[model samples]
Target: MADRLDYGEGTDAQQFVFLLPEYLKDTSKKMKTGLMFVKLVNPCSGEGALYLFSMCLQQLFEIKLFKEKHHSWFINQSVQSGGLLYFATPIDPLFLLLHYLIKADKEGKFQPLDQVVVDDMFPNCILLLKLPELEKLLQHVTEEKEIDKKKYYKYSREKTLKWLGKKVNQTMAALKTSNINVGARVQSNAFFSSHQISSDKEEDYICYAHGLISDYIPKELNDDLSKYLKLPEPSASLPKPPSKVAAQRQKRNK
Candidate 1:
């Protein structure tokens, strides 16, 4: 398997070899001009959805998140590649959406933002000590002597990934309700299918400064991007079941 390029956190702007900054600049201009590049199916209608999306992006930059290389890479790749690399923005969109909710709460929208929403919005910001609050459970396991630590880690990781996937789908649905669509499904599937982390994972995870490399990325770096963020690969489609009548006919012929 060929290695894929991973721009880990992309902190420096000087390393992008094949990236076209002019395209990013043009996109920002278009986004500001209220032009609809992608079809949106929002209830807000007109330019309200675009305005809100722009506002979110603006607020994101105001908070200094725009300096984050992941975001820069996301914005550039998304536009330069024409949405082929939409997932390059590994940060959850909800994190950005939280700013809007916070503003709405300040204005007495929806009876103030809930504490749960605050934590959801700022998971990395909150600090807690010790076990904090605990909830008791009625059911008890009789024998819990031996669980394989590796297996437990794998199981927990799988469960967490599953939960995150559902949340992502729900967020996408919510964004769509607001008439915002991010990427084409076909392109997304192709991205996932082409990038898989396996035995050569160590070499595959090498972090490269985008601007420091040559004008073009190494061939290995073009095949995978697991170092930037870990995501579940899209599953290969299952084969369709054979038709029963056809199977019986074939058996009779045999």
Candidate 2:
């Protein structure tokens, strides 16, 4: 019964279905999958939805699909490829996969079965984490004191990667059941001097960096990615203005 479910229903759904035959035919084709590394500044803690998702994937996918050679290449290539540089932050691996999936889906290059594959593995991926929780997690990490900065950053990065690996494993495990060969690997590259992490402008810099990656993504996938990433929406409530009485009191004092 689960095999009959059609998980593709958005604007580009039909295009994905149309591409399935090609993927099926080229089952033996080997393509080098690349993950451009960017450190995540804030990550959801505890049983944070994204963290849980990552944990699941690591247990299920990465353990099975990722080969040593492929993993090495992914990390090595990013350093060689060269692009806009930014400070490394702790990022969930599943989030990275989702980003790639969004890019492929938007290009109409992803197969429908692949969507089903994602659904089976991460049925509640987006639902698990709320926007506020995600935002708070980032704030918590970035707001740490300078004295404990290195320790906090290391802890966050390790924890984030651990969960991410789990998520990748889970996703791959689900794909294996469908006879799909899916995999994930870790990659790291040297940070460029031009992309130094500035303390004062970190927030805006990170936001813009994420936007740059999102911009290159196809339109169909952009909305979904934004939604998943908790990007602010136009209809979201604006912050309340200062009280008139408080404003008047301050003016009088001045």
lDDT of each: 0.25, 0.27
* Every candidate's CA RMSD: 21.8, 23.6
Model 2 spans > 4 angstroms off: 1-132, 135-155, 182-254
TM-score of 2: 0.19
Residues 19-120 of candidate 2: C-alpha lDDT, one tens digit per residue: 112322342331211111112211121121212112211211111011122211112123212221111112333343333233344444323322412333
Q: What is the TM-score of each candidate against the true structure?
A: 0.20, 0.19
Ten consecutive residues with minimal summed lDDT in candidate 2? Answer: 181-190
lDDT for model 2: 0.27
Q: Where's the lowest-lDDT run of ten residues in candidate 1?
A: 134-143
Clashes of 2: 19
- Evaluated at residue 52, the lDDT of candidate 1 is 14
* Highest lDDT scorer: 2
